[model samples]
Target: MTSATHRSAAEIGRTATGPRPLPPLGSQSSATELSHVDTTLSNGLRVVAVRKATVPLVEVRVWIPFAGEDKLHPATAEVLAETLLTGTARRDRVEIDAELALIGGDLGTGVDPERLYVTGSALSSGLPTLLDVLGDVFTGAAYTDAEVGRERERLIERIAVSRTQPRTIAREALQKQRYGDHPATREVPEASDVEVVTPERVRALHAASVLPRGSVLVIVGDIDPQTVPGDLERALGGWASDRSAPRLPALPELTGGNVLLVPRAGAVQSQIRLSAQTVPRTDPRYAAVQLANLAYGGYFSSRLVENIREDKGYTYGAHSGFEFTDQNATVNVDADTANEVTAAALLETRYELGRLGLVPPTGEEVESVRQYAIGSLLTSTSSQSGLAGQVMALASTGLGVEWLQEHPARVAAVTEEEVAQAALDFFAPKRFTGVVVGDADLLAPKLTALGDVTVGEQD
Candidate 1:
């Protein structure tokens, strides 16, 4: 038997008598500019058209900031999203679906506390028809009582079931804990409140916030960039409003404090949801921060997973990530484990958080995650829908495809020191405030042994 020789860590992935190196990576770069057009209409609808001649279809994204001050707007807005396409003045639900089908197109609507999103796709030849249909809805959606009633019933039913989900329960507690009674705290309104939302209320909310002003439209795939503005003008020029779309009451700065524990009876698992305020993508430190997040738990191979799932067997999966917005961004960590192991899992999680700050990431680790970050950016923008999706998401933050194209350069340029600093600043356990939702009887004693305890019941 041969004896092995000692080697430095850098000497790893290689050996004196080792397997030959695999094929070399290609030297080509992916920082090329995306060919596209960007313009905002006189009515305040921003249009971005990317010409991709590869496929016969076009992906469209339209975003309207329909924020309002009403305590019941979320419930009413949800109903509006569900019923908006049910019927319009010119076309009933059947006619709308049939028209879209004829053009091999479809559209869907959804709302968060912040904005209303309309996403659709159509055969390239049917761009005009798709736009016309969208324009029709924008100008003439009729929230008929029957359609609104049915949608409201369906929405309330979903909300009823969703409230029972562990993740939902934890998220609600975290949002409330973080923001108090701010409108942002109430993303998914109460089912009872939703049941009370009438067609007239929805119509009023629509009239106040569903205008073309303060909206963006994105089209990608086999479209002529030069003429998209003209076509958009022809279709959407008539859809105009002079009033500004209402804005969300500004989100309060998240103040990090103690862990919020929400009780659930007879549950066998626990959810840990953590939030730490962080910088936005536009910040110069963002690249390093992004890499730091990936190394910690933004991906499967991150430190959080390495400690909890791989080493401890406490949970099947764990993750840490960021949710970016126009004005702010936040770091979030999530884990779910058996009720019995909940306290231990959270202890290990906090241990990892502190350890990452103390030790920082090694140069090798930073390089590996940096490569992953850059690779992910390239992959996400490689296809037509992928590019369209990235652009649409960025548009919400007032960013363009140029930001996506330029991101690879930033990721590649991030140094180990930068990632380490970002880690120390953002990954420290004290920087976070969070909630642990689980069977209180099973969790309270163990978690109380770990720190100050707050036993409570909340939904």
Candidate 2:
């Protein structure tokens, strides 16, 4: 018994004894080693190249400053951006698909409200071949009438199906209510508009929107800048750097509080969206507002999520985001929850907004969110795909490469008081526009206590 007791005491001492190593104090130091981007092209094509010898893959992205905001030939720019890959002068749809499939590569393009992006990824061994193919597709696309009609059908089908999704309907409705007649608010084209979109319009938009002077080329992974730039220039130099397009128009003024509720027949839940005017992308308060939004409802542990989801069990998720574009800026909050709790959830969201106006985040919380955002940004820069995305964002916004290099410091310098001020400026209830998609008949009585309500229905 004495022997066993001594052995146990020794074991306990061993378990509790000795010094433990401390964790790395504080967060990681700001990333000092960033990619070397040379913006040498004079025709406004911001070229970004990263020569990483480790991976045998390359990601090339061409971001053109042509999106819905440009609106040159109705919807032609967007249609061209979408269907360019369907056929080029040298390659038809089937042939192009077969070639890309054989090499396990993909061709894709998209249009947001502010910019058009064409992106493709392929193995480094196939870089030279892919470049030729990419050049042909970008510069030599033939927007045939057949292709236009086909893509129109596909788009119509997409719209028809998307309208059935509650989230999609809610988002479209919300934008219309928030922005009113602004072209940015037109998320989906009507059947009349879609039918009128012709091949001639698509060709006309291509001529005006895809100007070499306003484009940027970003290439990352196993590549040398010297050789790649020369080759790209040769392949794409034929593109005239003529400045033909006019400057984008001034953004429309914020259309004040108008609620739009699209009445669905029997919706079990309601999707609600609230938006208010915010500072533009170049605004000095951009980073400060970002930190404040994180504290409000931008993250998983944000106040809105903690209160509405964790405590109240009212929503699957509730979050907010800031949309910074060339013409306008806005902060948006979204939640989808049971119909019975819709008004409560909205009121709680308003309460959070009002609270931010009254009291700001603590210095500690502000710093934490700043650190979180910077860390995430750095982590994104670590990958070639993410690096290319960063370049594309800078190009789309007419920001220089140095903008990203200085982002961490900018975020770090934002003070708690500044964040509070940004919140008040952005989250004014009077400026907020509300939109709901659900059974209006069921939700009317429940939401009537909040304010005067107007309901709309789709044909």
Candidate 3:
């Protein structure tokens, strides 16, 4: 073979003039105006159907406000979601599966403290069958004793495994620290409560909480937007109630204070979770806040990750993102670091937070994150499923496809000054409070010495 020379990575990245400048981002194309209908059916379900004719498949999402203050509400709600599609009066579990399979369809149900979610998909031709199956389950799910018993045991096992996870433990501590005993904190149900859940309790909850008056149904794919609402009304006409679905009680605002040091004895690594309250998506300042978040820690190239992960090697990854609960929203930052460096990681994490406000993202940094924000929006809604999910989230907040189409313009209009202001107002170090969970013996001295940190009893 003839000998050949290869350039080093540095050489390959350079031109005669030196390092090459990156090509400018191409002009972004606006999304096609979606053909969609946003109408409330006579049966009280808000139906939003969009015609995307790109594929022969249709995606479905249902959101029902399923909140309760009862002590056993979470456990019962969990069991109800597990068995919701297991059987209906007209079809047993296997029969339900068979009918959907014949139509290239599948369905799943899940619940959290704030809402119940039923997500499904099917071939466009099978839209009628999918709606009929959904209507049947909504109106007449049996929650048979056998099905409830089996699923309860499985849920209990899953909960047991999840509760032991480091992330789960951190999440629980943070939720409690931020919200006190708000029902929204009941994200993972207690195994003891799930064990005591009976079929009767599940059915009772199904009747009381799974109403249609305050629910939303989103359908996107190759379908007629105008006709789908009529079809939904016909199929689900019986699944109605005068009582609206219950919204969760508003959460008390979070106040920043000392970080709680929760002891996870003998752990080799630690989880650092930080949170601060912020405006919801509907707020006028939200677009600016969104960009500020991306530049801070919402994206991989953010200040927090660049400082802690790339420059300092404190953690494998670090992220900050928004969490929207109903009409409320908050920014959350998290990282997992070795026990040896957890204290240092926390310091740098806060340092970056403070720097984001004081130093602020430069004009170049703002432009970079702005492009990422718009590009991600376009990418996420490029598919039928993605569009459906996006619409569902907006509809839950009383918005529709119009908001989806207009969000890019909103983001584009946010000025660099607005972003800097948002960073200063929302990302101040004094505006955050959270938890540092690790071995107290190893972490307490260094962490407590860091100030704004308090050692707590072992968890």
Q: In candidate 3, where is summed lDDT lowest over 10 consecutive residues?
A: 23-32
Per-model CA lDDT versus the true structure? 0.86, 0.74, 0.93
- Which rank order by TM-score, best down to worst? 3, 1, 2
For candidate 3, the per-residue lDDT at 360 reads 92
User: Least lDDT summed over 10 consecutive residues: which range in candidate 1?
Assistant: 19-28
For candidate 2, give the lDDT of residue 426: 73
Best by TM-score: 3
Select the stronger candidate by TM-score from 2 and 3. Answer: 3
The alpha-carbon root-mean-square deviation between model 1 and the true structure, to one decimal in Å, is: 4.5
RMSD versus native structure for model 2: 5.6
Residues 1-459, model 1: lDDT tens digits:
999999776667666888547565454367657679999888888899998777899999888887767778889999999998988889999999999999999999999888898999999999999999999998889999999989888898899999888888888988887788877777788998899999899888888888877788899998889899999898988799898666676677775778878888888899998899998888999999999999899888899999999998999999998986557789999999998899999899888888887989898789778778888787877778888888988887888888888898888888888998999998888888888988887898998788844677644
Query: Can you tell me which runs of candidate 3 are displaced by over 4 Å?
Result: none
- Residues 369-459 of candidate 2: C-alpha lDDT, one tens digit per residue: 7878888888887787887787666666667557777888889888888988887877656767778788888887767667745667654
Q: Put down candidate 3 lDDT per residue, 296-368, tens digits, no spaces.
A: 9989899988999999899999999998888889999999999999999999999988998999999999999
Q: Measured by TM-score, how close is model 2 to the native structure?
A: 0.85
- Pairs with backbone N, CA or C atoms under 3 Å apart (clashes), candidate 1: none
| Each prediction's RMSD to truth | 4.5, 5.6, 1.1
